[model samples]
Target: MKILALESSAVSASVALTEDEKLVAQSFQNCGLTHSRTLLPMAENLLANCGVSLADVDAIAVAHGPGSFTGVRIGVATVKGLALGADKPCLGVSTLEAMAWGARALGGDLCCVMDARAGQVYNALFTVEDGRVRRLCDDRAIKLTELAEEIGEAPYFLVGDGADLCYNTIKENCTGLRLAPAELRFATGFGVAAAALPLFREGKACSPQELDAFYLRRPQAERERMARLAQTK
Candidate 1:
């Protein structure tokens, strides 16, 4: 299957094209530009360079949620438009899962995390065995201390944009934790494609309208608003 995937769930954004399990073309940028400006252009450039358009792609995939709320919204919205326009299937892979898929080559425990701020991270656990990723936990927003306790010294590679923060916060407590290399630390378009292909084969793809963001918690503004309301009440 030809899959076109987009990733903008964190600081960096990337677009990738994959044929079956092989990544054919990818354009990545971590230059601090707004995803709205960089994402579509990158996808267009990647497809154009690959000599394939949306019509040629069998599925449109995105890393949805558990990172920047605006970033996840942009990615999911982009995929929805492209898939709807091309009449292609839509794959909404978890941002954490996509990171895990990208690091499948590490072949051990994977602790995917994204900085969710306020001493918390968006995280999920996965184990890669024989080149396939098996999810160990549902995606969640968790405190660093709780996460460290749950991990309990088992050897694991930290992944995603928050790897460094997570590692530093709990490193003393979790002796077996190691930071993944720089290249494997962030979510990428290729990772989204890698995570989506299996779901596509399992008949789990959705329509454009059904594809949606998966933020683990409400945005900070919303939380603050609720807090204010509670104080007034």
Candidate 2:
């Protein structure tokens, strides 16, 4: 099976193509360019370079949420259009899950954290054993102190944009924490493709109309608006 995946849930944006479990091609950029200006073009170039067409892909996978709200929307919308145009199924992979999967080779407990600001992070925990990832916690926005307390002393390798923040905050209390190397620290298109494979095999891929972003919390702008309403009331 062939899968084309997009990852733009953070500052970095990447496109990747995979056949079965092997990567065929990938393009990544992190020069502060907006995903709107880079993601689709990157995908086009990657497919062209690989001598493949979007029509050849069985499914389109995308990092659905828990990162930059705009970035998540861009990825999901792009895949929605591609899936509709090519008449293929779409798999919405979780951003935190993809990050965890990126560190699967490390083989131990994984704590995925993405900067959500306001002294909190979008976080999740997973256990990777024998190249397989199992979720130990659901994705949610949480305070660093709460995260540190919940994790306790279970030696975990952290991976994500917020890894440094998590590591620094809990390092004193949790000496078993380790930061993932730069390459595996953030969401990647290849990781998205890998995470989508199991979903595709389980027949969980859906039509373009059913695809949607999985934002664990409301966007900041929405939160601010609601706060104003509460103040007035």
Candidate 3:
């Protein structure tokens, strides 16, 4: 199956084209917070290099997130537009799931923690045994302290940009943890998109309207508003 995949759930913006589980081409830009500006253009370039157009793709896959709200929306909205125009099915892969794929070579309990900000992270636990991911903990927001307390006594390899951000805290908290190598620190468009394409072939897709980001916490703006209301009282 020919699939077009998008990754804009973080600071990086990337696009990938895959054919029959093999990578054909990818375009990635991680210069700064420019996913909104560069995503479509990157997609265009990747497609052009692969000599394929949106209509030629059998399905569109996206990282439906527990990520940057703006980043996730940009990716999902872009894919929704392309899918609608091309008349193709769409797949929503979890952002954390993609992280697992990037670290499939790590060979142990995989902990994915993306920065949810305000002293918290969106974390999930998975064990990769026999070449497949088995979820040990559901994805949700937790304070770094809470994560450390809850993270069990097992050798874990952490992935995601957020992991890097909280390195000191992790070392202090998640005791006896084994960190994954730098190469597997973050998700790649090729890795994530390829990992999610099977569902597209199996007719496991959601309506565009039903596609949603897995935000583990309320938006920061909402929290600020609630704080102000509490102060007023």
| Candidate topping TM-score | 1
The pairs that clash in candidate 1 are none
lDDT of 3 by residue, 1-233 (tens): 88888989876777888887678888777799578789888888888877888889888888878888888989899988888877887888878887887688788888887888878888888888787677787778888888877775556788887877655676766665776787676767776676687677677876666666667667788989999999999
Give lDDT tens digits, candidate 1, residues 93-150: 9999999999988889999999999999999999998898999999999999999999
**Candidate that beats the other on lDDT, 1 or 3, i.e. the better one:** 1
Query: What lDDT is obtained when candidate 1 is compared to the true structure?
Result: 0.94
Estimate the TM-score of every prediction: 0.99, 0.98, 0.91
Q: Candidate 3, after superposition: displacement of residue 116 in Å?
A: 1.3
Candidate 2 residues 58-155, lDDT tens each?
99999998799999999999999999999999999999999888779888999999989999999999998779899998899999999888888879
Assess candidate 3 and give its TM-score to the true structure.
Answer: 0.91
Highest lDDT: give the candidate number.
Answer: 1
